[model samples]
Structure formats: C-alpha cells, structure tokens
Target: MDSSVSSLIRTSYLEQPSAEQAVHPSVYSKRKRLIDIAGALVGLGITAILTVPIAIAMQFDSPGPIFYSQVRCGLRGKPFRIWKFRSMVVDADQKKHLVRNQAQGHIFKNENDPRITRVGRFLRRTSLDELPQFWNVLMGEMSLVGTRPPTPDEVQKYDSHHFERLKVKPGMTGEWQAKGRSNVKDFEDIVRMDIDYQRQWSILYDLYLIFRTIAVVFAGQGAY
Candidate 1:
C-alpha cells in the first residue's frame, strides 16, 4: 500500500477516539439508554417467568441465598453491584482466594470446584446464573454487549491501558466471551480483547458478539 493510503487507513482504523468525543458517538449511536431499558425489561420478564422453577430447585439443593451480588467496576470506574443467581456456597467470596482452584493470572476457576452446588453447576454451565444482570443493563450500570465488568480486586491489578475499558459501560458479554470465553487465561489477553473492542466499537461487532455468545453459551464450551 502507498504511504498516503496506509496513513489514512491507520488514522481511520487505529487512532483512539477521545472519551469526550465518544459519548453516544455516531459510529455506535445505536447504543442508547432506552434500548437497554426496552431490551432488559423484556429480558427480566422472561427471567421472572423462569425464576420460580429455578429458585425452587436452588433453595432445595442449597440452604442459602437464591441470588448473589458483588461490587464490580462499571463505566469510568464507577462501582455497582452485579447480580447473579447464586451458583456457589454462601461463603464463596470469603473462601475463593484461600481455595486452591484459582485460575491463571488472578482469575478464579476450577472445573470441579468444591464450592459449587448441584443447581449451581447447572446454572454456571448454562450461564443461567447471569440472568439477573439484565437489571443492571436496564439501570444503565451495564450494556447488553460490551466488556465484561471486572471485580474491584481485578481492577486493582490492571495496568494503565486496561483502564481504557472503563471508558464505556461494562457489558454482560463481549469479544472475550464470544471468542474464547473461559479460555482467556491471562490478564494481558483480556486487556488485548478489551482494547480491540474499544478501538473497533460498532453495531455490527456488538451484534456479532451477541450471536456468537448465544452459541458459546449453549455449547457450554470452556465454561466452569
């Protein structure tokens, strides 16, 4: 390619858009507060209808809470509680680090983590535990598709570039989920995916990730 054409392409494709310029920018204008509201409302309705049976099974199988909530960093480092159906013992948070099943680069996972309950395993495998997060999307604490929200502790470990992910709303699913899901082994790999999404944020990419996520979730591949 000629230098002039290459320069144009670089400016068009690789330059980072300033945060102030991107709030509801035209390239990704389809993302809006109301879209989240309408989508999450319908999603919650479906979850509400399904929750009864799932809740009963969860309660019977485990003697503790039916739901779990944790503080996660959202857009621009804002803190919010991300909700999920309980998929582990009530003491999971307290014991997670002490346990030996922690995964690579500060991620915690184990295929046979002893903390999981019968219902919990199913929920985690099928990602049914994540249903309550639509309320987060409805509240604008998250996007239906974007970068996964990181825990406060996880954020603390991030380098300077990783902070760029906070420039947009945290997502329920995104490039990492659709591409590799739990196979994302290191913090640097995650940072690369998040930066790639931010640089190429577009409606088509979001839609692609959404459909890909559905397939991966159904396959339950690499899920723990």
Candidate 2:
C-alpha cells in the first residue's frame, strides 16, 4: 500500500545522516572526544570533592579495594572498564552466580541482594557508588546520558534487534535509570524502552532525563 511505502521511506530517512551529524557524531561511529574530556574533568572534580570521603569510608568499612572495575560492553561492542565505588566483598563476583537473579532485562540487580555490604547497601540506595563512572565518561567509554551499558555476556545473548543499543555511547544514567530502574521487572520492556531511546534521542530528551535522574537520586526511589 502507499501508506506502507511512506512508512518505509520515513524509516530510511531516519537512518540516514542529518544536520546533527556534523556536530553530534554517531554514538558508535565517532568519538565525541571533547565530551569525554570536559565531562570527565568536571565529574572527577566533583567526585574528589564529594565522593572521596565516602570512598574512604567504604574502604574502612570493608577490607578490599576502594573502587571496583568491570569490563562492560561499550560502543559498537567494544569493551571498556566501568568503575564504581566498591560496595561488595572481594569475592562478590565469584558468589554472584549463587544468588537468585532479580534483575529485569540483561541487568542483574536485586532489590535485596545479599552480596551488598553495609556501606555498599547505602551507596547503592543513594547511587553514590556510581559516581566513579564519571571517569568512564571522561575516558570516552561512556556518556553522561545514554543507554545503560551491557556486559559482554549480556551483549552476546542479545538478538540482532538489541544491537541497535550499541549505536550510541553507554551512559552512567539513562532513561532506564531515571524511569523505574529496579522497579521495571520485565526484560522485554527494558529492551523496548532502550529502542525507544534510540528512536527519540535528542538533546532535549537527554536534558529532561538528566533532571529526572536528579529527582530520582534525591528521592532514592525504587533503587536497591
């Protein structure tokens, strides 16, 4: 039908380059190096001024590294180290498989995960633990706002449709984080939202999500 042809044309047009292409590079195709540098510097400064004390407390609360780093899938399936303030025991990864899966989508979070340490519990509930990801943002491995990064295993499990998420840089906070986070209990719904982000990505949308994230962080709502 003519309507079907029009729909196809619209989809094709969206897939092509647009005016935003020169200023804002494709998330996977080009590196927005400036964003990485400036955002990271500011983030690092804020983290040092505000989060270092908390990091010190986390170290004292447990006998392990102050920070935790894990290999996460980045743009175009590239692997990058995602940093976070350590909120679990040294053996957390080894014990993860033993715990019941409580996450929605490819994520593996739990509302009452036993692996969380006392300080970790607070950090997670308050989202302070994720402050370290500003470094990832600085390192060009992530963005301040984008789709949540997936693990290698999760990426491997993804269907072809899920690969679209890699078209943009991963983010420290995203639609998922701002919307429901742990409250979203269905994996398919998570994928749907991620796809929706790609279809609707805009600077305004990112800004709106960022403000919403601030509210969510302040309220500490639905976060484990």
Candidate 3:
C-alpha cells in the first residue's frame, strides 16, 4: 500500500462514526451457497469448453502461464488466491508503475493499458478472463454475486467504513459489474454500491444481478 493511502485510511478510521450498525448477518446464508454451487457448475462447464481455445490464443499472443492467480481479500478480509486467465504480459505487474492509473482508487485500471496482450484485451473486454473464478466459487472461496474482491494491498488502504463491503463473500460478478464497471471512476461509488448490496441482499437480488451481468457482458458496456 502507498504511504499516502495508509495515512488516509488511518485518518478516515479516526473520523468514522462509532454508532454505525453492524452489517446484517443474513447476508451470509445457506441459500447463497446453493446459488453459488449451481452457478459454478454451469460456469465450469462453459470454462471447460472454452479452455483450449483461450489457452491457445493466450499462448500465441504472449508466452506465459495460461492461468494467473493473485491473493485477494475475501469475506471479512480473508486472503485467498483468485484465479483468472492471464491477461497481460508476463512482466505486467513490474511495468504497472510505468503507466498512470485511469481509475480513481487504490486499484489500477487503464482501458488502453499497454501491458495487455492482443488476446488478453479481447478476454478482458468479454470478461472471459474471469472464467476461472467459477472454480473459486465452487470451492467456497467466493460467491457468484457479491462485492468485487480487492487485493490485499488495496484492502490495506481501506477506511474503517470500507470494511463493511467485505461482510459477505467476494464475487465473480457483482452490483458494481452490473452497474457501470469501467465507467465507475470513483472508488467511493464502488464502496457505496457494495454496502448497498450488503444491506439489501437477497437471493432474488443476486439472480437479478446475474442476469444483468449477462446483459452487460453481451453488450460489452463499460468494459475495458
């Protein structure tokens, strides 16, 4: 985490109201698991069918491992490896500091990020890179719908209020993605949406978001 962001989190923590109510316990429920399991099974089947073609494309586009895994903060800040298709050059992380961030947050985002390979760009835009995360969902590390998972570094930069977003499991797709994902330049907006989802959570809402995500993915709206 950046020193500046660390300082901000500290300052925000100090300023946060102490009387804020705890996140609803119902956000974590057995019904959510059923949804996750069903979604993951279907998603894994799709992943199985697409794996070979995606692998070949990624290999020809750039030589590296086909899959990428990184530690991401899950429910209540638990660390777990989040899987995805490799969508950048092998040295992408090393080169991250070379480019300016287009998104306004601790997280990095650049629509025209130079480190993205040709095949990777298509995968990212289509959200095909995120396919492997269904395995994470199947394994109980993630849910099919919840808040976007943050990197540990990003979580380290979070304010006290921001921790509320992690009250439920991290997700493959969420309210943020169903809303304008790339169009959301401000991280605070993402946090607000997350908190809202946590507060208003229901199986029906999750289903709605899943269907909405399918529409968003098909339209390729607000995607990099």
lDDT of 2 by residue, 1-224 (tens): 24443344334324434432222243643334554567678878878987668867877888788889987767666677899988898899999988888766677867777888999988888888888999888767888888888777676566656666766788887878899877887767777777677777776676688789889989989888
Q: Which candidate has the top score in TM-score?
A: 3
lDDT tens digits by residue: candidate 3, 97-207: 998898887678887899999999899889999999999999998999988898877877776778777667888888899998788878898999988887778889889
> Could you arrange the candidates by lDDT from highest to lowest?
3, 1, 2
lDDT of 3: 0.83
Q: Report the Cα lDDT for candidate 1.
A: 0.75
lDDT comparison, 1 vs 3, better candidate: 3
Candidate 2 clashing pairs, residues 3+ apart or interchain? 105-187
After TM-score superposition, what is the CA distance of residue 109 in candidate 3 from its true location, in Å? 1.0
lDDT of 1 by residue, 115-196 (tens): 8899999988888888999999988789877787877667656555666666678888888888887777776787788778
**Alpha-carbon TM-score of each model against the true structure:** 0.84, 0.82, 0.89
Model 1 per-residue lDDT at 217: 95
